[model samples]
Target: MTTFTDLNLCPELITTLKDLGYKQPTPVQAQAIPLVLAGHDLIAEAQTGTGKTASFALPMIDRLSRTPVEGEYHEIRGLILTPTRELAAQVGEHTLEYGRLLGMRVISIFGGVRFDNQIRKMKRGADILVATPGRLLDMLVQKKLSLAHLEMLVFDEADRMLDLGFIGEIRQLLAYMPEQRQTLLFSATLNDSVEVLADKLLREPKRVAIAARNSASQQVKQSVYAVDNGDKADVLSFLIHGGNWRQTLVFTRTKKRADQLTAELLEEGISAVAIHGDRTQRERTAALAAFTAGEVRVLVATDVAARGLDIDALPQVVNYDLPNQPEAYVHRIGRTGRAGQQGRAISLVAPDERRFLQDISALIGKPLQLQPVPILENGKLIEGGKLPEKKRNQSGKTRKGGANTKAASKAAKRAPLQPEEPVAPDTPGKRPSLFGR
Candidate 1:
């Protein structure tokens, strides 16, 4: 029964929430907002769709607005670092929305775009800055901005930042900011790496855990289809066609795999697009936009590229390939079943991926039941039996590498996702398009 008004947020935020049709604070918001407004460093563990952004943004805006900075040029008072460009853009959008009535200026900076416009925006001044670490560091080195006046620092998706190997960059960025600022770390899961970072950065932080650790959303009905690696494409096509899925997010482990899957889906007469690190910003943005607007039926993405995707009412998420890390499985399925909407998460597990599936199950503290793969033939849907056991050497043990290592190697070399021109360190701003348009 806790409401935004009861949480002691300012009237401007309350009005904005009402305008956005948000009646009550979500669990994380209700808990973390108060702590943030009270000027406490916090470590909040909440699921992706649990309003984690608002929990920090609303309170940060309120606190900053109460104490206006005295200067003709607005200095960056708040900084939020995200793992990927997509996430930075999404968080920037949300922050702008939440603080609009208060007249807060928010800007997002990431690589893959030219720096001229971003520098111009920074010169105009931003009250809150959302940026990916690499681009932000570039700006700092170039003397385009300063974080010395920052009053608050937030690490959104902290676990993801570490997963993307941004720890060193994060540390380097910290050296540029004032040490006295209030720091808030929000993540879906808090593993040991995150714990170490939190210990180093926060001072007697308040911990808010909105859900069980590494747990997938209950709203997501998770199931697995056991199949051979070679038959995965056919099974996926059968499922999509048989179920008549309109909007689906598919996760692949590698950029190469994402591209291959997307191509295969298109060849099957299914609308699909691939997004990954190798893609240019313009391409990534367009692909995401098309998928969001339902112009594309499926979006195939690697784990890094899909980190911060926010799709409303996404009905289905297909794990085209099981992730190497079990925690990523939770984050992948999280793309669907968001904001209390019922969703389905289906994983096509090859025999080699059974171990990966088991790791995922263990992390989530629940056993994922394996379902027989479905076959579509003559316009009929039928069970296709369990997956065959992994191939073993004559010694009766699973092969050390894989059965078709040579073939896999050849495929990887032949069809690698074409990498875009590298973003030159000095001219990062010249790239086309920002993420999350």
Candidate 2:
């Protein structure tokens, strides 16, 4: 029965949370907020959707509110570093929402966006900064931002930052912050590297774990569908159509795969888009907005979207391509089943991906139920695992204007539908459907 008021959050913050419809503190917030409020450095290990952002944000806002800054100079008072631009923006937004009535100034900085505007925001001064390591480092080098006045440092999704090769950049950024600041390092897993980072960054930190280490939400019903590599697109299309999934977050192994899957889904008349490292900030923002607003039915993404892409009441997640690391599988499916809502995680497993599936199962400590692929009546071949032939024909020759590819794509979009035949129905070895549709 713990509430935000019981957590010693200020009246302003309590009112804000009430307005935001957050009646109770999540497990991470309940456990970590006190230690942060007590001014102790902390290392928190929790799942992605466990409200870890507020765990540090609430306390930081409270401390800043009580100690009111007197001067006009807006040197960064609190710094939160994330792995990806999407996560940085998300954390920044959450902090702003919670600190809205407190007169807190928050800014998010990351790469792939114009520096002119971010520089303008920085010049105006920010009470809290949520940023990706690379862009933050660039600002530090350019002397556009400083962390010497920082009272708190939070590294949200610290493990993912390491996975994205930001450890060196993180180390450099830490060197810029004051040595006496309260450091909060939150990671989904406490691996050797993360532990080392914690040791180097935090001092005698309090440890908090609100969920099982490196585990996805148990509320998510997970399933796997065995299909040929060539049939993955068709199978995916069938599942989306048959299940009538409205807002699905699909993960792929590579940026190319994300784009290809998006194209395929669009061809199937499913409004879809891809977000990845190569996309500009404007493109990424537009895609995420479209997906969040339900303008798009499917969002095909790489691991970049696995951690920070928060969609409210997202009912389904699909592993279009299995990640080589099992921890990633946990984060991918973690996007759904958030805030205690029921969700489904569907994985399309090809013959070559069996090892990945095994690794993921072992990491999650449970086997995913095998689900039969929905039958597509038309036998038309939908290329799945292979590279898209839009640019080059099957003969390995570049097509002029890609006319045939456009025609084929149009045909796929306009194709008529037949009643789906349930694959592997009533088989002796068949497992119960996890999706319950």
Candidate 3:
């Protein structure tokens, strides 16, 4: 029953939280805010949507606001490093929202945009700076900013930073900042690499774990459909169309796959867009805005591009391509089922991806039962049979096909849907009927 007021947050932040309609402190915020306010280096493991941003942002703002700056020029007292531009933007927005009443100045800088604007903003000064490691390092090398007076350092989504191979950049950035600052590392999961980073960055850190490490949210109902790799797009399309889903987030392992899936969905008369690393900041922002506003029916994104998406009440998420890193599965599905709302997480598993599925299941400590694919029959949707098993060679290894062969290339270009036999009626109390009738 603890509230933001009980957390001992400053009155300005408490009022801001009230105006934002946040009635209570989430587990992470309730536990980590006090330590942050007290100037303790912290390592917090909380899943996405658990208010981790506010946990650090509120206290950091309160601490910074205690002594107001004398002039229009504000020194960067707090630095938050995120893995992706989207994340940096998100954290920056939240920090601004929480600190606005206190006259705090916050700036977010990342790549894929004009550097001069960021430089100008930095010259104006920021009490708190949110940045991606690469852009932050670039600014340092260009002498656009200084962290010499930094009082707090935060690595938001620290695990994701490592996953995106930002560890070296992070280390390099650290060398530019003061070593006496209070460091805070917030990650969804604490693996060995994250543990090492925490060890190196934090000094006698206070630890807070609001959820089990590497676990998917219990509010998300997870299901997997076994199909051939070539049939993934059709299956995803079927689910979206049949279920009449207005909003869905789909994840692919590669940027190429994301684009391909988006094209296929668009061809199916579904409004779809692809977001990935190659896209400019403007393009990514537009795509996300369209998706959030429900102008886009499906948003196909690679894992890296989808990192800081904060969609409210997202009903469905599909794993168009399972991630090789099992921890990423948790992050992908975490996009949905946020704030205790029910959500559906569907995965299209091909024969070659069974190992990935197994790894994901093991990491999440639960078995993901494969379900029958849904198919169209007489223009009605029905459950289809399980996928056929892969043939084995004399060596007992699964036989492989040449994916680049002319026949394979021709098959890839064919219409995404293929004929399938209807197996059984839609079971009651499972997923809702696909027909949306």
Worst 10 residues of 2 by lDDT: 391-400
Per-residue lDDT over 164-223 for candidate 3, one digit per residue giving the tens place of the 0 to 100 score: 667667767878898899999999999877888888889999999999988999999888
Of the pair 2 and 3, which is ahead by lDDT? 3
Q: What value does the lDDT take at residue 261 in candidate 2?
A: 74
Residue 391 of model 2 has an lDDT of 21
My TM-score estimates for the predictions, one after another, are 0.87, 0.85, 0.88
* Tens-digit per-residue lDDT, 275-349, candidate 2: 877788889899999999999999888786556887888999998777777888888888889889999988877
Model 3 local distance difference test score: 0.81
Q: Evaluate model 3: give its TM-score.
A: 0.88
What local lDDT score does residue 373 receive in model 2, on the 0 to 100 scale?
44
Top-scoring candidate (lDDT): 1
* Clash-forming residue pairs, model 1: 113-429, 114-429, 114-430, 114-431, 115-429
Q: How much lDDT does each candidate structure score? A: 0.82, 0.77, 0.81
Clashes of 3: 0
Which pairs clash inside model 2?
Answer: none
lDDT at position 128, candidate 2: 92
